[model samples]
Target: MHEGEGEIHADWVLAGRALQDVWILPGIFHGTTLRIPDAARHGWHIFWSDPLHHYYGRQLGRAVGPDIVQIGRDDTGQATRWSFSDRMPDSFTWRGETADDEAGPWQLVAEFHCRRAPA
Candidate 1:
């Protein structure tokens, strides 16, 4: 993977009330390595590099396609679910939300990475 940066928004809530809304304006990645500049403030394990890239890549048997990773955490800062989906050389769409009750179920956010096909 190439070097990149992105944003992260974490909502810390309890009993349906938002306690904190933390935003990491810039998340960094270099050569498939990921780092969260404000991880300490946002809470532990709020974000990280895809640890299952090799496993999923092996399962798919090829590297050219869209790979998706989904993560869900509850209000108590516990991971409730984690999953991934991939598509090969075509348009695709995803629906639904996170399964964790403490984490509000809302539409998932997706990031797409595409490069030009060779001639």
Candidate 2:
């Protein structure tokens, strides 16, 4: 991860048919995300929790195009959208947005351009 002049690290591991994402920002933050695919719905169910901030999130993810996947959650009238795009074997881009409602002009909250570490 990249923010201003600092760096964050992430690890992705496969577990059965699901994937787990572990994120670390040194002492500042740490979080885990689990993604499970729903084949019947052609989408994925995503769960995230950050104990450091006492935060948790649930979202549904679906592919919108060949290289774009969007995950969104609508809870208590608040909605959030996180999208991954520009995917390649070694790189991708992620964006986060929020909206008041489902049919919304989403407001950008964060963006990250990422590259995979070489083996």
Candidate 3:
């Protein structure tokens, strides 16, 4: 990621593991999965930091970001649980489901309120 004063970037490989503590300055962003000989199976999600409390660094009580989740998977690899948070805005949202198959439709799993602890 780059802040635009000068170009700086870093690359990471997500191999179906949850990532935490990925902090970077907001800037242009792009993602791609290449199929050299065949496609690979992987899962990925990003929970941004609470910019207002950047120093807290995702601390349980002081940090927050758009919270997205997925539950059971269908045969076609669609999420049986899909939800988005409007409380905390995010630059972008992504769900792994694609349009290649029409066998399954995304289903909402649950609804709940989120609150941050006093800073």
Candidate 4:
């Protein structure tokens, strides 16, 4: 991770069990949102942190730069770029682009472990 980059957890296997911890990939930001459909096999979601009120670094997101986040596992990739301006709130709003004939329809499916923490 960078000097102030956020982190995400990654699972690991050792011996006969698995381990998990914050992602240590350098320069990668710790995404914030994790949304998905009710289907067990549906793809999951992860929202990036807010550049301003959210903990990024000493300098605000403006001083740094807007970020375009992409979520993918295989060679295929999907990307959406957004900016955090002073006029905007920390909360995020997703806006899709107008699909054109040039743009083809795409579909994705994903699976994730849904284990609830103890009360």
Candidate 5:
């Protein structure tokens, strides 16, 4: 697998109730994601599309802990999770995992220990 660096720009929209993220992978893939909270369900509805890869999907994200948000999609029997941890003022860890089913023996797909870019 190829390992490389990318940048993400996030913004709060819908009167700060929703989050939108734009990812730049520089010739690999670029995508935009929107996350809107579903208070009744205690989770967020996630929508993303990456035209370069011809990929798009929807997922549900729920906070697993104070610093970790896990998102999963169950429609295809291929669930994916993204966990955030080790947060600091200028850095954090993001891990990606996947499983054949929602009841997972998850396999790690990627892990990024990210730091703030120099201003």
Candidate 6:
């Protein structure tokens, strides 16, 4: 994966309103890896990851996407909504010529804001 990356955004549709906690993480070789530990049977699992290099020897996949990822529920079903803020993610990474330069790791920290669904 690259040690440097830009920002990205996406959307997700959840299952029901009963689901309480919501988390946002980027996907991996397979999206399933970012699944919540014990989340509802069906819901959107958002995520971001350190940048990675593409097969074309180019850089892509920036972990900095979406500003405030909010997942909530109404009377009918659940909803996941958020906008890509102008702000950059807490951290980033990119793959360059050196395979191992060591740049404090692309593991940038993120701010999480979660709330309960309406009753």
Worst 10 residues of 1 by lDDT: 54-63
Per-residue lDDT over 23-78 for candidate 3, one digit per residue giving the tens place of the 0 to 100 score? 22345322222111112323333333334443111101111245543334344343
C-alpha positional error of residue 71 in candidate 4 after TM-score superposition, expressed in Å: 7.5
From the highest lDDT down, the ranking of the candidates is 5, 2, 1, 3, 4, 6
Off by over 4 Å in 3: 1-79, 87-103
Candidate 5 lDDT trough over 10 residues, lowest sum: 68-77
lDDT per residue as tens, model 6, 1-119: 42222223223325532222222243422111122222342333333232342211111122234432223221223222332244433432211222112232223223223222334
What's the TM for model 2?
A: 0.79
Best by lDDT: 5
Select the stronger candidate by lDDT from 1 and 2: 2
lDDT of 3: 0.31
Residue-pair clash count for candidate 6: 16
Residue lDDT tens for model 2, 1-119? 34642244544557477778776666556877788889998898888777898767788889887555555664344677888889888887878777886577888887877777667
Please write out the lDDT profile of model 5 over residues 1-88, one tens digit for every residue. 4478999889998899999988787866798889998999888898877878776767888877667666676345478887778989
lDDT digits (tens) for residues 26-114 of candidate 1: 34321121222233443222233343332111111111234343344533444333332444454323222344353555444333332
TM-score of each model, in listed order: 0.24, 0.79, 0.25, 0.21, 0.85, 0.17
For model 3, how many clashes?
0
At residue 12, candidate 4 shows an lDDT of: 45
RMSD (Cα, Å) for all candidates, in order, is 16.0, 3.2, 15.9, 17.5, 2.0, 15.8
* Candidate 2 residue pairs that clash: none
* 10 residues in a row with least lDDT, candidate 3: 55-64
Deviation in Å, model 3, residue 23 alpha carbon: 22
Alpha-carbon shift of residue 85 in model 1 (angstroms): 4.6
| Full ranking by TM-score | 5, 2, 3, 1, 4, 6
